[model samples]
Target: MKKKLTGKTALVTGSSRGVGRLVAIALADLGCSTIFCHGRSEASCRETARQIESRGAKAVILPAELSDPAQVESLADRVLAAGGVDILYNNAAVMHPWRDSPEELSFEDWAWSFQVNVFALVMLTVRLLAPMKLKKWGRIINLTSGIDKTPQLAAYGASKWAVDKWTDDLAAALAGSGVIVSRLDPGWLKTDLGGPNADHEPEAVLPGALVPCLLPDDAPGGSFFRAQELRNFSLD
Candidate 1:
């Protein structure tokens, strides 16, 4: 039986556990042949790979500390050597220890969030673009959070906004080039980062969250999606 994504290969970052793990499995279940699972722990990545293989898909563990430029470059080199993938899910991110306010937020917190959430994402995408552009087919889903301003999570929110801006521009640049870029706001869910107080469960992100990743060529680009719905929201 031919599946929707049978011939596709995907790189799902931060896929060791939580929503990242679920997303990787979902893609695998749909018949993605090669799934690159990124995380800090080799054991977790191995577990994710096992689960992906259980779905009859190939899983390759790609471990890297997104906060480290050298490690990120190494990861990119490996992916390029393996042949770039058809889909890139920039799901990994960091929410550093909170400070009372943005002003109180230590430089380390701001730097860490941006390094992982913003800088690493850009670096990986730029590295993968050559293959995607040449193949004339690709999907880049940049995971983001809501627009709400939480003083406690100031750096995190700001980092997400940066990605939001980046996605918007990249979507426009890739328009009509057979590659689509979009922002996916997964909403606050009960995950390691979201905590137990979150309203929804990790599974609640399914179906809708995956929608933008599988968009048709003619589908609107540069759209901000909140789960399944396209939103007209702003970072400011």
Candidate 2:
């Protein structure tokens, strides 16, 4: 059988390591010939590209500070110059130490978190959605966290809530526009962010991340999907 994304080009943000790295590789294996793996550093992004290309696929490495809208615009322009983006997985995220109480969070920290976690995502989608619309087909999959499920953190959870709302509103905004907007929570995977005690491995998140990008046109939209249970309302 043919792979789901044989001719597709996927851009997996923050793909230097952890869940992002795994997701980029999985998409390549699924036949995404052009994989754009982005990172804060060139060396890291190059390593991700190496991992993807070793599997017999072409890849592009984009070094970007996603929090900066200017850099994001440049990145979007470069991608548009190269070709169309078929699948976009907005997976990068950051937060202050959870040890800090609500009152302890500085205004600066909160602002920075939103810029990176939410604003940059919106910019990327806005730039790419038009092209996707022109073609009348595309997938926009935002990588959200389980924070909304267990909300002890402030800035992090708030940003994800914004993402959840964006996916919902974007889906409605793009109705009849042929662009599907959705999110995938890869569970509590053990990584630098998830900590060593997390329930699942980093690899477990890939399939869940990949599923929403390949959702059928009639499938549910503005919803969340988890590896253990994929049906609607199971915020697992």
- TM-score to true structure, per model: 0.94, 0.92
lDDT of 1 by residue, 107-203 (tens): 8988999999999999999999889999999999999998486888888999999999999899889988899988888888899998999878888
lDDT of 2: 0.81
List lDDT for all candidates, in order.
Answer: 0.86, 0.81
> Ten consecutive residues with minimal summed lDDT in candidate 2?
227-236
Instruction: After the best TM-score superposition of candidate 2, give how far the Cα of residue 2 lies from its true spot, in angstroms.
Output: 5.2
Candidate 1 colliding pairs, count? 0
TM-score of 1: 0.94
Model 2 regions more than 4 Å off: 148-152, 230-236
lDDT of 2 by residue, 88-203 (tens): 88988876676446787778768888998999999988998877989878888887877754334788888988999999999898877778888888888888888999888887
Clashes of each: 0, 0
Q: Give the range of the ten consecutive residues with the poorest summed lDDT in model 1.
A: 227-236
Best by lDDT: 1
